[model samples]
Target: MCAHITDSVLYRHLWGTDETHALLDDGPRVQRWLDILAALAAAQAEVGLMPDDAARAIADHADVALLDLDDVAAETRACGHSTLGLIRCLRRVLPEPAREWVYYGATVQDLTDTWTALVLRDVGALVARELADIEQAARTLAQQHRDTVMPGRTHGQPGLPITFGFKAAVWAAELGRHRARLTEGRRRWEVAQLGGALGTMEFWGDAALPLLDAFARRVGLAAPDVPWLTARDGVAEFVNLLALITATLGKIGQEVYALQRPEIGELAEPVTTGQVGSITMPHKRNPELSEHLVTLARLVRSDASVAVEAMVVEHERDGRAWKTEWAIVPEVCLYSHTALRLAHTLLDGLRADPDRMRANVDAHGGYLVSEPVMRALAARIGKHAAHEVIYEASLAGRERGVDLRTALLADSRVTAHLKADDIDRCLDPEAALGAARSFVDRVAGEA
Candidate 1:
């Protein structure tokens, strides 16, 4: 039986993927633990801490498939030791001389932490690739809709004019920053953990540091300058970064979900012909992909909090903290990967209703152009006075069911210098989208 929610059969689709399944599966995990033992033996031999022939023999045949996993599990339960089962299983497979040398001087943390590093390294590659794909999709959308004007909302209310390109550019920029964060986190997270009992490497004597470096290189990871048995910051930092990435994707997803509303109709996620939205309501086309991204992000954020909590570990090795990570880190990575994958798809097939955007913008009868009008009026009067004048006119217009132009034209304080034509020109949605295109260009250039 699996211990984590990611491995649960019922909820698996929400929090897991094949890639993560492969990375965190029992078979792969045991194989990696065996690989760690093999590398440890080789490193010990390379530094003259163990017999070369013994190390070679252990490395030659440390196959996880050859072992009796049932016996290993029984021994694990009996001994209450994390890797005693692994050691016994490997010993059974190794020659007499090499049997005793397997997992020579390493502790549970050394094995588990090294495996954690391996998982992080692999998951990091997956995340980077997916984020890159997402960024590319967002870039494509931004470029394609460089001037597609829409009403930009604030607090769920239509407030001002903005281009679809500007919205996409924001997503691209956020994704680009996440890519950078992932890149930076890789170095800090991909380092090895070879600290022995008490993290002193005392068991290996003089061969410790070199063996660590050699072992890490053999496993294609960086050797830490010091033992990180209790320094859980790297793991915390890595998961936190993943959380940030998911949060940004979730933000984009939330926007899509909101804009796909029938009342707004500014954006729509791709709807395949045969896809079912609701059995009761056959005509509905829900933003399922976008909404799922948000769900994945929420789960990732929760896992990230768990990861951060693991950072407050006690002493050199805390099973409580490290064990929590065994569940949380992989969960966060899986959730993040899901979010990124769906986010890319959401962006790639995203459909914008330019006509609907214009219609929505026109529905308010020039209220979205309030900023432009206010700015133009500020040139006549001070900004504060102009804001007050516009606010009263806007209120009266809302009460009387007329455009701001009609109300402003009726007010002598507003009509003293401005004519109806000037007000009409200021209320143009296209004209009101100040610097949106420039911002889109800037994002493209920066990205």
Candidate 2:
């Protein structure tokens, strides 16, 4: 019966976690809707808008398990009303007094919007916790590899020398910024929405604002100054943050996947027994988790674009814009949670070959450290003049298939002030990692 890949039992674990699914699944969502209705009744009574006994009756009998969901869906189809079906179904199960007060004066947006707020609130906390764990893992990696030398690449080519700690520190700092955003964003995203029919509380008379405040308090949310029936910016802001978080995760995965290549052999993702990388390649081990992080990030970003599109509305109520969230919200939630979970696992068990990284840095003879030789010669000769000499020598080295050290030794202009020993001293990979260790210390120290 499942149509979307997210709903498939076999594929669901790849896309979402059980903790997130419990919050977004249909049964759980309906139960939350019922809980919202009960809160509404209790608030109405607190503000003297409804009888206390009526509120109690509605609360006691509004259990989703007690109501017949089949009739609810059938009535939804028959009436073409978004919430009337649920209300009608609840009335069938409730006694007379509670039956009339089930939904009270609220509209569909009122119920759905508040539920959205509640979902964001819960998911926000989950995201914060997971992000903190990811940051910690990055910090650990950075500290452990503070002096682990590696070739820093640019444009897919090894350009210079850098410590592996520097790379992990960059990820840790970015994650820290995301954590700050999530902390500040909760206030804006967790506020309640209780605007009745076009956002004007004409039905509730003088008890309108009080009932709204009471309802928000009952549900552990802040009451917005005005109903956000059409203002979709809060939801947009929240999902946008999720997109940014996933993008950061994707960046980390990209590095891990690239460095895990057999040619590079600098980094390796953890592999356990019984895990198959490729069916045909018997000896191959693939970066499956790292690659999947990238895939998850792409899908979440696509969902984020649609979520932002939902910001444009016609008036006080635009099902066109708000209802798009019915698809976007859950997808972003599931994708983001699953991405964070995988990233944490990858980082925790990640393997790094310090010896391999050192070997790769030394693979190109002295070409990778040409900048050091260029800089040392620049001080003796002029800057641009030394660059031209080194550039020509580098070309000759490439054309003749000899290393930069041999080519530089042959040039009497480079040998006039420096010897082969000086070239060897400048070509040391550990010497080229200037300020890398200090930066790693700064980031890990702050941790």
lDDT of each: 0.86, 0.91
lDDT of 1 by residue, 1-447 (tens): 767677788877767778888888778888888888888888888889899999889878878788888889998998898888878777887888877788888889888899999999999899899998888888888888888888888988889989899899999998999889888778888998987888889998888888889999988899898989999999999888888888998899999999999978889998877999999998888899999999888888888998889988887778888899987877787788777778878888999999998888888888888888888889999899999999999999899999877888888888887888888899888888788888888887774
Clashing residue pairs found in predicted model 1: none
Whole-model lDDT for model 1 versus the true structure? 0.86
Clashing pairs in 2: none
C-alpha lDDT (0 to 100) for residue 6 of candidate 1: 77
> Per-residue lDDT for 86-143 in model 2, tens only?
9988888888877788788899988999999999999999999999999999999999
By summed lDDT, the worst window of 10 consecutive residues in model 2 runs over 93-102
Candidate 2 global lDDT: 0.91
lDDT of 2 at 88: 88
Give the clash count for model 1: 0
TM-score, one value per model: 0.97, 0.97
